[model samples]
Target chain A: MEALLYNLTYGFSVALTLENIFYCFSGVFLGTLIGVLPGVGSLATVAMLLPLTFALPPVSAIIMLAGIYYGSEYGGSTTSILVNLPGEGSSVVTCIEGHPMARQGRAGHALAIAAIGSFFAGCVCTLVVAIFGPLLASVALQFGAPEYFSLMVMALTCASVVGGGSVLKSLAMVTLGLLVGIVGTDVNSGIWRFAFDLWTLADGISVAVVAMGVFGLTEIIKNLGDDEIPPTLLQKKITGLMPRWKDLKQAFAPILRGTAIGACFGPLPGLGGTASSFASYMVEKKVAKDPSRFGNGAIEGVAGPESANNACSQTTFIPMLTLGIPNSGTMALMLSALTIHGIAPGPQVMTSHPDLFWGLIASMWIGNAMLLILNLPLVGVWVRLLKVPYRLLFPVIITMMGIGIYSLNSDPADVFLMAFFGFTGYVVVKCRCSLPPMILGLVLGPLMEENLRRALLISRGDPTVFFTRPISLGFMIATAVLLLMFLAPVYRRARKVAPAEEEG
Target chain B: MRLKIKSTEDFWAGLIFFGIGLYAIYLAWDYPMGSALRMGPGYFPTSLGAILSAFGLAIIALSFRLELENPAHVPWAFRPWLVLCGTLVVYGLMMRFELGFVPSLMTLIIGCSLAHRDVHLLETALLSVFLTAACVGVFIYGLGLPFRLFWWSY
Candidate 1:
């Protein structure tokens, strides 16, 4: 505890430097801005900004990026509440209750609660990181290929089962994603496996490119058609931005519940931001007095899920940094960035580069503080954007997107690719097929495959080694249990309870 | 009104994906995939591709089942896909010409407007120019990107 406290004090001393604080604020503000504007994801923004960080010390650079990350997760909810559109896909669940609360004239309350919950979740997660990061790293050092393979299997099962729909569809999408992930050249052999002869395919698809194209670009294409939504939409004055005492009282329980749940679930493999929200919401409903108020703008509904989402987003790093494995799409992008800088994330990263790992964890707290100050007063400025004409809005958004993407490699092809993905993304959304699983599949597949094959190599091609080891066996059992839990009749009956209606 | 989802779109799409996956898996069969003894690289890819194809077929069956049960849920669209596609083409063509960010985006925006009959040419041009200048200034200049100030600067 003393060492942990000293580390945090050291962390704060480093983070409080004016230069670092400035970068933290810059990252958070920029993150929130992207979060408010749809089609410009933090992942793409971070990837594009990566080159700029090449000159900075690893600590400052990582701090700013982490700020952007946590900021966007919270910032996306702001738009989700005010406008039904989720700035980032991770906040899709936020729109369920968030927008409803807005429609019911509780927009201020929803926004305030989201920010507070985010702040609380971020703080709790920061403490968790301070305490557990070192411990987790020590444990992870013992992990070999078999353990990794089992972890991947468990993640795959969790992703499939928690995909929020029929297990069959989820499995299909996951598998398809995995196959697409294999399109690049084989690392062990000098042969290409699934490259369709395209040079780009040989390198495989960039997750940022695919995600930005499919999710971000796709969303713009959609708004192009449905731009006008009953022009008579209510424009709330949004009064003061502070939460009412009553609302805060209501928000308290949810925040605690959410933090506990978030801390527990955040470190798990395969549980992304989206699943974290679902699990929180489900648990909240089971614990709440009036379950029916859930979809109808319940305050706790806003608080719990938002907190859980942030916790999962932050703690996911525990695995990625300690194990060199990413549990979600966003982290995969981060890992990709780290790899470019000659860092393979995992247990060794902590020992080899304590400054980088701890700096990032410590920076998260500073980033959250930066986000709170950046977002609270600036709430007025963001809401004012609602009044902008769609035509004007589109051009500015397109420009920012163009500049961000083009800057990636000075490759104009990426620009066109983004636009193409945008159109295709819209089509997918129109089809009611969720892109989360696809993104998850794309991000996790290659990592899973890499680990699986490595484990197999160690075991001399014996596939059963995944179950033979005690740790691997436990993970495999957990995965099977998760699958069984999801597929059970009881789970299905509960999920089928009611349908939500969308506001125009 | 939401467009009625195609009666067979889901199943067909799944089948197509399945076929592609299978074909890739077949090609990977010859890649000397590392086995347990040597850890050949192509082994995981081949196996994953095979699994994908198998799952794809299963998805197609499930999709077919859903379609048969709920005919109304065949995917529907609100906007003409042509406009979105046209905008993308404009982006590519302008990019090929090495048009600077502003001019290329202007043309692309105008072209996208052309998709709907209700376009105002003057209005689109104005908005596009405004957007281009801001983008060039904020994202490029302000952010200090190495963007070419002129289209032909190599």
Candidate 2:
């Protein structure tokens, strides 16, 4: 109780500052703008703004950037619904039902539900973090090399098993990502493992480069061949812009359920937005009065997954801050930004910098409220954005991808890398392989290698250290349970029904 | 047209992955990794590599024994393959030619666009030129990297 009050007071004091408030609003606003644009992403937007943040105090900079991260997820749904393209990978699921809702003349309802659900989830989860953060941080303190290795293994396996495509293909991509991660220099020995002799390659690949290539540019290259027209508006009526009472009743349950599931899954690695969304949808289907409404633009579908996506985005910060492990691409960038400021992210972060933690926590609530205002009136404005011709839009996307990649290091080589990966990702998509595992593998690979090396060093060549550690042993057990689910016939049936249920 | 695999290609692909995994296991040999904080570096990779190789073998057997397929796939799509692989090859070689950003990117765009013959030459060239300019202005100039606008040393 005392902690709760302290957090509330601490957060309010930190979040209400004139500068933090202004930047928070600015980040979310820019975040939403980019989010509404189909090919542009807030990652690139924030990355572009990072150089500017160098002059600001570290806490304010982090607060604003974090605001952008969540705000983008919230606003990215606008594009997904109005246009079929997602602003980011996480919102891809929203497109299936969201666009359907838009086409059904409920675009207003769709946008409203997403905005409201995201705000509610964001606020609720912020409170959860305020209450549970210290306990979770304490738990993270016990992790060592073997424990870290097991955690990454679990995340990798979970990502593969839940990926819902050919598990073989997913595994192949994971292996490929690990190899790509090894491209840069090896840190321990200071020896370059696979730089391929290019000086640029010595630093290996940037997440911004990989993300723009895979999600941003590759999308353009792939869509250039498909001749589908952008979606047409179904109605001009703003009546029932707010959800109907019945719709609200339907959404409330899923929003709560989504929040619960998200709080648990969000902290787990590799399960960030995509997994939380998947988990939310599956649970909604499992308990639905009429599960048949699922793919047919069920309002529940819109609420549950959107809420989960936002919640998971917030919780993923846990790993980055508590354990110094970045669970997602956005978190990885955040980790680097902090490191750039010479403020290492670990358990010590909270103890050593309470103001930063409390301020960030408080700003999340403020940011969400700002987002509600930002998204609510602009629903129509965002809708009009979909009307922009692809010829014009794709060029802008291409430009943003270029400029965003350049902003990271001002390297033309990085742009070249983006263009190259864009081509491969297009093929990978055509081949029906999932790229989520690839992203996971890239982020986890280096840490996996380092932990493996460290573990070996500690054991003096003993193989039993992995199994002997209690925490690692538990993660290994979890992995085993996950594999069993993969093998189960019930799980196979769920996968079949899952896609079909989503076909509407 | 969608092509269906007769499971033969699956077997060979799985076989290749399995073989590579086996090689990785072989590579992990002789590194005496203690605990992570201690000595050797190769222990975990060796064990994991062995497991991965076994998983690869299981996939091979599963492919041979059972069939699972998706409707969206063409057993082989030459258009996408040609464009993807062909562009990558050009990008790889462009470094050797010491091409400037504009020339290398335009050439890459032209080459990749040509793979899709449905696109007209004029349209493809314009798009390529447009993309090249975007790259120059945004990545090279906007980021302010100390790169030459042209490739020549002079």
Candidate 3:
């Protein structure tokens, strides 16, 4: 306890620096700006903004990137409430009750509640990270090659099975991603595996390039192809930014429930804010005195999912920070950012760079407070931003993407590579293959292979070494269970019916 | 009697995966595959390739399963697809040839705007100038990134 407090105080000292604070503010502010705009997501925005952070200190760079992440959650809920358009996947539930509330001239109330709930969740989850992150990191430090390899397998399995898609297709995408990861020169053998003789292929395809192509460029193409017109903004002047005392009282319990749910799900691999928010919505509806009020303008609907979404976003950093494994595509981008800054992600990050770990946690709280201040009184400003037409917005977004990728290495090939992946991404989506598993595979593929080789080398060709090691065996069992659950007939039926249920 | 393929999406997806997997296996065949204890570079890729092919075959088999409804086939949006991808390729060429940053950016914005049906010439022109200026300010001046603004600047 003393060490944690001392470290937290040291974190505050680092985060409170004027420069770090300014970057944090800018990150959340920009996060919200892009988040409010329809058709643009945090993943694309972070991928685009990544190059701009190259000049900063690693700590500040990560701090700003992290702010962009959670800040977008707060921003996504705003659009969901007012326009009934979900800015991010996690906010899709907010539209259920939030839009109806807006139609009733309570847009201000819905927005305020969302901001407040997110703020509350952010505070709790920050504490969750500060406490659990160190413990997890310490445990991870003991993992050897076999354990790490097993853990990667478990993560990849969870990502494929729980990622909500045709498991076969998702697994294929993972295999393709692994192949893509193997394109660069092999580290151990000094042999080029799949470079196809291109100088650019010698160094593997940049994860940023893949992210921008898949997330940013692919999104723009999708929005352009979409035939539906953008949703009209609520024209009424929003008044009464604060909810009544009664409404707050009703929301209080849901918020706490949401925080608990989110805190548990966030640290797990393959599950993220979208799942947590949906789970919270279900739980809130089940617990409500009147279940019919859920799809109507229920206060608990907005409070629970919003809080859960924010909490999930905050705790996602735990796995990435401690284990150096990213659970989501956004987290993958964050890990890549750390790598670019010459910081190796893993258990060692905490012991070696205490300031980066704890300072990031402290800064998240500050960023959330900043978001509340920015979101409430300035709700009108965000609404105005929504009026910007998709036509004008997409062009600017693409231009920035081109410039961002180009600036990364000043190589035109990177931009072209991004374009190739953009087309591939579109095809992948059309085929109903989930992109997250592929991305996870891409990032972890090289690491998994490296560890597998090391473990095998240590065991002198004995494949049983994986089963003999207790930690490795535990992970293997978990992987088996996950795969079994995926393959179960009941689960397969549920997966098929899930889309139709969501539509209804 | 013609065999009816149930899910077109799954069929195509499986074919692509199968093709890629076979290619991976064929490519890795030449590399030295050492013993399990001291595995060579080829070992991982060869195994992944074989596993992927198996998955591909499984998906193809599953596509034959009875699906209740015929999924709606949305036609590919080829116009936007072509124009947007063309814009990126052109931008790459411009950068490759050292065509000035402003011109390259102008091409990108204008070309991308053309992807949509309703394109107002004035709005696009003004947006191009404004965005280029902003990019210059943010990427070049603000971040101190090295870039040639115009062909002459080179």
* Interface RMSD, every prediction, one decimal place: 3.1, 5.0, 1.1
What is the CAPRI rating of model 3's predicted complex? medium
State the lDDT of candidate 2 residue by residue for A1-504, as single tens digits: 997788778878988989899988877876776666655455544444444454468888889788777777777788787767776556777886788887777878888888888889999898877777778788877788888888877867776776566666666767766655656666665555445578998887765567567765555565565554666656655445666788788899999998888878777755667667877888888999899877878888889999998888777777777776665546766765676577967777888888888889899999999988888786777767667655545544444444355545655577668767776677666655566566657766777787777776687767688899999999899989988887899997776544311000
lDDT of each: 0.69, 0.69, 0.85
Q: By DockQ thresholds, what CAPRI class is model 1?
A: acceptable
Tens-digit lDDT track for model 1 on A1-504? 888877777777788888888888887887777666643455544544444454466677777777777777777788788888665545777888888988888787888888889889998898887788889888878888889878767776675665454455556666767776777886766566676676656777666667667655555566565545522224557754787899999989998888777778776654566666766888888999989998998888889989988887788778777777665556666666676567767789877877777677778887887777777778878777655656555555545555556666667666666667666666555544555566657766667777876787788778899889999999989988997887697986664542210100
Q: Per-residue error at A202 for model 2, in Å? A: 3.1
User: Weakest 10 consecutive residues, lDDT, candidate 2 chain A?
Assistant: A495-504
TM-score leader: 3
lDDT of 3 at A450: 89
Task: For model 1, state the Cα shift of residue A268 in Å.
Answer: 3.7
Scored against the true structure, residue A27 in model 1 reaches a CA lDDT of 79
Question: Over the stretch A170-245, how does candidate 3's per-residue lDDT look in tens digits?
Answer: 7788888888888889888889888888999899888999988887877777777777567776646998697789
Off by over 4 Å in 3: A497-504, B1-3, B66-72
> Measured against the native two-chain assembly using Cα atoms, what DockQ does each of the candidate structures obtain, in the order listed?
0.45, 0.19, 0.77
Best by DockQ: 3
User: What pairs collide in candidate 3?
Assistant: none
Q: Per-residue lDDT for A320 in model 1?
A: 71
DockQ score for model 3, please? 0.77
Candidate 1 TM-score over all chains jointly: 0.86
